[model samples]
Target chain A: MNRDFAIECERLSRIYRSGSIPGRGRETPALTDLTMQVPKAVVFGLLGPNGAGKTTTIRILSTLLAPTSGSARVLGYDVVKQAKQVRERIGFILGGDRGLYGRLTGKQNVRYFGALNRLNPKTAKRRGDELLERVGLAAAADTLVEEYSRGMKQRLHIARGLLTDPEVIFMDEPTIGLDPMGAQELRQYIPELVGQGKTILLTTHYMLEADMLCDEIALIDHGRLVALGTPDEIKRNFSRLTIFEIVVNQTSETLTAELSNIDGVQHVETSAEGIFQKITIAVEAGVDARDQIQATIGAERVESLVVRDPTLEEAYVSILT
Target chain B: MAAALHNIALQAYYSYKGLFLWLNWTAYISNVFIAPVVFVVIVTLTGRFAGQSDSANAYIIGMAAYAIPAILSGGILQSFCYERTFGTLSLIYASRSNRWVTYWSKGLLHYPNGLLAAATSLLFGWLLLDLDFSRLNWPALVVLLLVISFSCLCLCLFVGNFSIALREWIIPVGITNGLLLITSGVVVPVDQLPGFLGEIGRVVPLTHGLSALREAFEGASLGDLVDDIVYELVVGLCYLLAGGFLFSLLEANAKRTGTYESAI
Candidate 1:
């Protein structure tokens, strides 16, 4: 394992076998020979759709689950062989509101987990107080966890995950069930943790969140790594087609066909809203279709036109599809 | 080593904290005292109707022994089941602290609760019934309670292993409670049971422990009950070892199967 990489997995494969009775099950592979490395102190995002093995990868790296055949090392410690050492240096928060004790206060939950990580009593208490404050949960520290809102509970989860002051943190869909403002608030803490030299492996299905937070991203599909790069690099490399969105007072098959026939235009799709027709055209790289698009649709019928680079979502869709 | 000890202590603290802090006093009293007292009264009354005073005294002692499993099986079931249901089992498993140590800490914390319930039942039996306590061997009774509590905890651990593996605690705990009640010589003497079941009862820790308690109540010393005490200890240790092995196996299987990620 390289010391510079916070996490390194070599051909990791996890196959789950299922059957009602023992020795009579079919095997389903969740991860297939997936090899990747995450550099230290980077906010690494594992972006994928649901059931894309992102959580499986996080679980294996964090020592909650063992890979079926391959090896994974976190911070120079083998996840399987040196699992306790790996656990000592790492922490994780899974998505949802079920991890905390409903009967215990928010502070009590943090302190209990701190103790589980073997922190001394005084240190655990101090760290719990600091983390609760940092996560905007100090005000609700003494409230029973069951009474806290989903966002408050999620913040408490974050505080508990950080109680150990781990060098590497794993967050699996941390903002999965939060409101827009809650998600925005949680996003602000990622950079702070990364700023403190902690390597964060975050898994999310939200392409926009990944784009905003990740320094490096790995796009996974069907248990395989499809693309890996910085957000801008991925947008530039995977997407070679620019998008043109046009709003017209009226549109029909003739206009769409005419736009499709324009030079360098690969495909033209049209949809009719209540009072306006919208046209999205994909054009080849280095080709400008502004003049042709305007001429084909007629300048008088056009209400608005916009030309821009493909977004990360468009890039993700293009690569996956 | 110190950290491990600290972890255990903290686990116990948190486990007990939840119980004491959240559970209402009325609920706690009803659960710990009412059920055991009612059961002892019913058994002693039935024995008295049969005009078997000796059997009545035996029934009272057996009912006191029954409290160990009554409190422990539920406590153990909750300890394992609640974690999975609450989604904290994976977090606990991922921590640096040893899983076995954490589980044992919870078990050890519940031990005193089980003893308290057992004592309540015994005290009620003495007060409600005209049972003779003047000849009771105090040290021998203490030893018997200790042995019975440890043995029941081991049995609970064994049941807890299966509960995690199956991802269902209610059924396993229920079956265990039924089997122990019918076969552990609590309401019926082991010698009077059917041949195979009586043999099974002899192997159960409660049978030996209850027999030892009866001997102590009848003025037998620790030396007189050495054989039964030894048997109880041996059985308790075996259950503990087997439970530990099963817990490891199920945990490894859960990891390999990805069941840890699934909700119970």
Candidate 2:
């Protein structure tokens, strides 16, 4: 009910019942008592692994799926009761290449979607051209989508999602299959759209993508919200343990056991990479076990040593574990 | 109202582009234009070989009526199936525009195409088979064509709804097409059909529409063929209402079941 929020949900839940015979199948909960709010004109990221209910949440908010219980509102309109209003103000780009007509050209696909949003033919065509150019696909606008590469198709998906000039856009892993350069270029457009005062709800498994693009991040697991804050705030709050990483020419079980016995060292993990061994030690705050670890492992065998703050991925792992 | 119309126009434009503009003209000609003409030719040749002029005439009219479902129903059903497979159905559902407008607009592509197919069949019959039109009641024929088109459109809508509602649409669509071909009195008179099939034939709009068309071709006035025309109109309306109701129920079920996201 907050007018200042672009999206608001209260106890939104979706329970999918399987099997054709009612009451004869198992019930799967895709979302559970989820409550969150996203303020207007900010980039919000829902960071989670696969099957973590991120896509389900996006589908519910986009008005494509109705919640089994509770409610969600987009721009002050109920996603279920006033789906038309919500849909009018929002656009969605789902992951993968399935949504497009492979037979149609990129420009034609954009124009078709624009028309579906009720743009006149001329306006749809003009806007479609503009969007194609904006997405760096103007040169290949006339080519069939089937002929385009995965990266080009992903870019076209972005252009189609923007055809309506929506006030809010839901991008569900838009860069899932893109190359490194392709993903970087696509990421650049997110802030540009936000600069124009549009709210974006992005879902991604890439922690770095979320850290780079999202102004606010909410991490969910098993259909439940686990952590919510800005990137730095999350790293600061959830990351209480210090970490020391050491690369050695060879590591034996004796060396790992010795490091484990060191006072204040909570956990030690090691993995073999080629001829070298990488070891990571998690220790309690205020503990300086670096010198002891170096002495136990023998400084001559140490290939490299570094101590650093926990990254977002490490923070996420810590929270989840 | 303006927005709805715009949506319709744009959807139709895109459907035509996808269906025709993207494909080779030769493919289009072979698929849409030539197939109907070939069917007419085969039927005429068979009828001529049997020395049954009256049967040949009936065959021509029946085949023309058959083209209605063949093109319109098939087109609409294929569009629905492809939308699911192509993953555009969810996108369309997510759009703010009215879903009914989008559905109907995609279907509009079939009308012109069906008309063209039917007309070509009739023209071929006239040129090659020397079919007599001297007794044709022009006004009645026009009315019959309109009624047939409306009835086919209703059937297409019904099939479209059924496709979305059913988890597996292929078997159901195949069965429905098979039933239409078998019981719609396309190849033979409903009266000549054995047992309960004749009774079921009486219920399909194609049966009524084809009956009225044959009557009009035989010089009957619209008033003279009142029963068939009335039956066609009633059947078409029934289909339209039933399809709309079923679509709502199935759509709600899909949301609850979470089947809407999958291509299935």
Q: Each predicted model: what fraction of the native A–B Cα contacts (within 8 Å) does it retain?
A: 0.62, 0.64
Which runs in model 1 stand beyond 4 Å of their true positions?
A: A20-24, A245-280, A284-291, A299-306, B1-6, B16-22, B261-264
Docking quality (DockQ) for each candidate: 0.57, 0.55
For candidate 1, lDDT tens digit of each residue in A1-321? 799999998999888788878778888888888888999999999987877888889888987778988899999999989988998899887778888888888988887897787898788989899989988889999998989988888888888888999999998888877778878988998898899999999988788999999999988888888888999888877767788988999876688778878899877888876599988898876897788889888899999999877778887877877
Error of 1 at A21 (Å): 5.3
Error of 2 at A282 (Å): 3.3
**Candidate 1 TM-score to native:** 0.91
Compose the digit string of candidate 2's lDDT tens values, residues A169-264: 999889977889879988998899999999999998888888899989888888888888888877777656678989999777688889999999
Q: How high is the DockQ of candidate 2? A: 0.55
Residue-by-residue lDDT tens digits, candidate 1, B149-243: 99998998888877776667778878887888888889888889999989888777788989889989999999999999999989988888888
TM-score of candidate 1 chain B vs. the reference: 0.93
Please give the range of 10 consecutive residues that has the lowest summed lDDT in model 2 chain B. B15-24
- Chain B, model 2, TM-score against the native? 0.88
RMSD of 2: 3.5
